[model samples]
Target chain A: MYFTSFEQFINMNGHGFYVWLSYACFALLVVTNIWVAQQRHRRLRKQIKSRLGRSAKV
Target chain B: MSWFDNWHLPKWFYQMASPKWFYDFGARLQPWFAGLALILISWGLVWGLLYAPADYQQGNSFRIIYVHVPAAILGQSLFLFMAVAGAIGLIWKIKVAFMVARSATLVGASFTALALITGAVWGKPTWGTYWVWDARLTSTLILLFLYTGVMALNQAIPDRSVAGRATAILAIIGSINIPIIKYSVDWWNTLHQPSTFTLTSKPSMPPEMYIPLLLMVIGCYCFCAWLIMQRTRNEILDQERQSSWVARYLED
Candidate 1:
């Protein structure tokens, strides 16, 4: 709302590229971190289930 | 009952050390923190990027602070926290402490990397260069390496308990860098600017700018809390795979 128009907001007084790039990278970092954590959790659950199955036979 | 029984740290304190309790707590809290993080970060971004007034000197590029400052602060704080958790693990022999320390290292490193990258991006516009060997920047880089060292040590050791102890020691020793990173701007002349937010003084920026920055910082912290809890829960599961509780939990 500080900017009078949408074009000015996008350009950000010509600093838009740098500002937007940093935000984009930040988004990537957040997404990748969550994805990795979820993957680890799912993988661990599978591994534990498999181990439990094996142990049940003994 | 003896006074000692009542005086002992709350019953939950001991329960907190149990991997099962921690796993359940983390699982329950992760989504809540993640949700808070999402809402706060989005609010900060919208206000910071669009509504905040441009800096007189740096122009709009200063907006990067919403992400950069929070990431940098989180990175440094996470390292300090890892060291404290490591110390607790060492003193109390709490496996949960060790697991939390392990989970924090990589996430801390990622935040550090984000800080460095964003700092560089901001620098090119403000400082007219993308990189500098200034003390603050250099010290922060070293902080990243220390995080890597802790993670590498954890992976290289085959024995979990031994690895935990060694990593904890490494984290404690490497913590010496944290103070260096924090004081580098004050102790030595550097191209990197002095910290904007401090405990003793009002922020130089107006409320419009500072408020969004504060939101971003809190959001980053919540995100970090969620991420660490998730990873720590996974670590607990992996480490306790042989335990009867894990077996029963897995069965369901």
Candidate 2:
């Protein structure tokens, strides 16, 4: 609301790069943490299921 | 049921310390924490980026505090949690405690890395240098190295229980660095600023600024809770893969 336009909001009186970069890096890291965990969980589940299926066939 | 069943605390503690019980409890808790994290993070980012007034002194460059402060606080607290969990595991030989301690390393390392990155980026604009070897900064760097070392030590050990015992010792010893990092600015002539929001004192910033910051800190904690739960659950699955419960749970 402080800014009159989108450009102004992004510019932030010439500090836009630092401000935006910090936020972007943070957002990326947080998302990556969750994503990596979810991926690991999925892989573990798949491994377990496949192992169980193989044992059942034997 | 024994007489202890009459007391909820011991019963809950015992149950909660079991891998199956903790896994089920974490499964239920993770989504709620994730939901709160998303809500609070969005609210804080929006408010901090758009509505909050720019600092009169630092201008919009100061806005980085929204991320920096929260990450720094979470990073430190996560390390503390790792140490305490490590201590419990060492003392009790509880599998759940060891799992929790092991689960904390990756998340704690990531957060510590984030804190350092954000601090360096914020320092560029405010302090005119991207990095400095100030006491707080140096100590923080050491903390990050300690986390990395613990992770490396765990991975190098083939036996799970032995690795847990070794890493737990390192974690406890490394915790000594935490207080030094916290009080670095107070103890030494450093470029880093003193603490802003302390438990014993009124916040230095106004409500408008501190409110968003508060929300962000809470959101970070929630995110940590969610992520740690996910890692802990994965640890349980890995450790208990041959157990009947995991097989049954996976079947569904």
Candidate 3:
């Protein structure tokens, strides 16, 4: 096994800081991308709706 | 008869060019891909974090590979995928392809950013430096910029068709860098390690260590696929609102 105990595994021989930091950054990035993708979708939806609304009124 | 066929990409591309067809296809594919992605990720993370032996030299720090390598590979490949979609849309004038390209570029750029940042973090400890101008590193830097350039070009053109063509040109030209990025470490001696994923010869790490890396790579890819579908559906809806069917579909 890679580690003797759960605690040591979590500790990662004190390299946990780096390991976890890397993970944290990766998670943040993925989350942010998802958020941005959603935002883009919403923005495009609004734009399309507004365009349609204008055309409909005319 | 078998469900799948030999000419997979063409058939897939044809189906993808129709928004309604793409939407149905995405719906079918998304859940399966997402489930497989989640399963593989869970399996890989558990094995990598707890089962695989720490690197002899790097120790536990090497665990970052489960994330970094896949992010990097997908980061690069997704751009190529977007460019191809853009080209198809531009040449064939398929609105769905352009929409897919637009949605995908954003996701690809995001992944590329993640890869570069994660790499920098890993580099700090292993290389005793956070960033450097090594050939491999430099090429990847260029890749990030290329992704940015394509994105900006797509947005700058006022007309959507012109936007697609402009970005397609940039994407095609930028593709030259993918090969350069792939070969940078090999072509030049550098601080960055040589290829982690390979086809032949003995793997640098043991099976336990590499397996999770493999799973994470697969998961990253699946996640990309899922994200693209999710985002492209939104794009299609946005672009196709003028179609009478959109109202009926959205009503549900």
Candidate 4:
């Protein structure tokens, strides 16, 4: 609403590149951290489950 | 006699020391924390980027503060937290404390890096340069190094206990840099401006600008809490794999 039009919003008075770049990097970092944590959690659970299966087989 | 010998921690504190208890508690609370973070951060970012009026002087570039300031604050706070957790582990020999300290290191480092990059991007437009050798910047750079050093030390040591102790000592020693980072702008003739928010005085910026910033900061902290808890739970599962409770947990 600050800007009159969507183009102006994206332009951000010609400082758009810098503003959006910083935000993009921040968003990427947040997503990557969450994804990595989730993956690690899944992998650890899988490892434990496989170990449980192997011991049970013996 | 040691000063803490007569001191008794709360019952909940003792319960939190148990990895299985913490794992279940974290799992229960994790969704709330994550949801809160997502809502707050998204709201703050939208309000800050699209709705808030631009800075009178620096214009749109100042918007970077929304992300930069929160990242920097958390980066430093998390390091200090890591150090305190390390201290707890050292003093009480609590295994869970060590795990917390370990989990904080990676997250802290990522935040520090985020702060640095965003600061540089903001600087290019405001300060006319992408990088500076100013006291505040240099000290924050040192903070990033301290975090990485603790991480490397943790990976190098084979035994978990030994690694934890080693990293804890390093983290405590590195904590000295936190104060240096905090006071750097005041202590030296740095190009970096003084802090926007101080405890004793009101925030320098107007509510429209600062309110969103506050939201972002709180959201970042919540996100960090959620992330750290998730990682700590994984660590508990890994470290306590041989325990019967862990086996039962997996079964469920």
Index of the highest-TM-score prediction: 4
Q: What is model 3's DockQ versus the real complex?
A: 0.53
lDDT of 2 by residue, B39-122 (tens): 999999999999888887778988888998788777778888988998877665578888898888888888778878877887
lDDT tens digits, residue span A1-58, model 3 = 7687889987998788778888888788768877876787678667766766677689
- Give per-model TM-scores: 0.90, 0.90, 0.84, 0.93
DockQ value for model 2 = 0.86
DockQ each candidate and list the results: 0.85, 0.86, 0.53, 0.84
Error of 1 at B132 (Å): 2.1
Off by over 4 Å in 3: A38-58, B1-13, B180-203
**TM (chain A) per model:** 0.83, 0.96, 0.76, 0.95
| CAPRI quality level assigned to candidate 1 from its DockQ score | high
Q: How many backbone overlaps does candidate 4 show?
A: 0
lDDT of 1 at B17: 92
True contacts kept of each: 0.90, 0.84, 0.64, 0.75
Candidate 4 or 2, higher DockQ: 2
Alpha carbon lDDT at B30, candidate 1? 84
Q: Tens-digit lDDT track for model 3 on B153-252?
A: 8878888767877887788778856786557645664335454322112347678878889999998888888888889888777667778766555444
Q: 2 or 3, which is superior by lDDT? A: 2
Sorted on DockQ, best first, the list reads 2, 1, 4, 3
The 10 consecutive residues of candidate 3 chain B with the worst lDDT sum are B194-203
Better of 1 and 2 by lDDT: 1
The deviation in Å at residue B57 for candidate 2 is 1.1
Among residues 3 or more apart in sequence or in different chains, the pairs in candidate 3 whose N, CA or C atoms overlap within 3 Å are: none
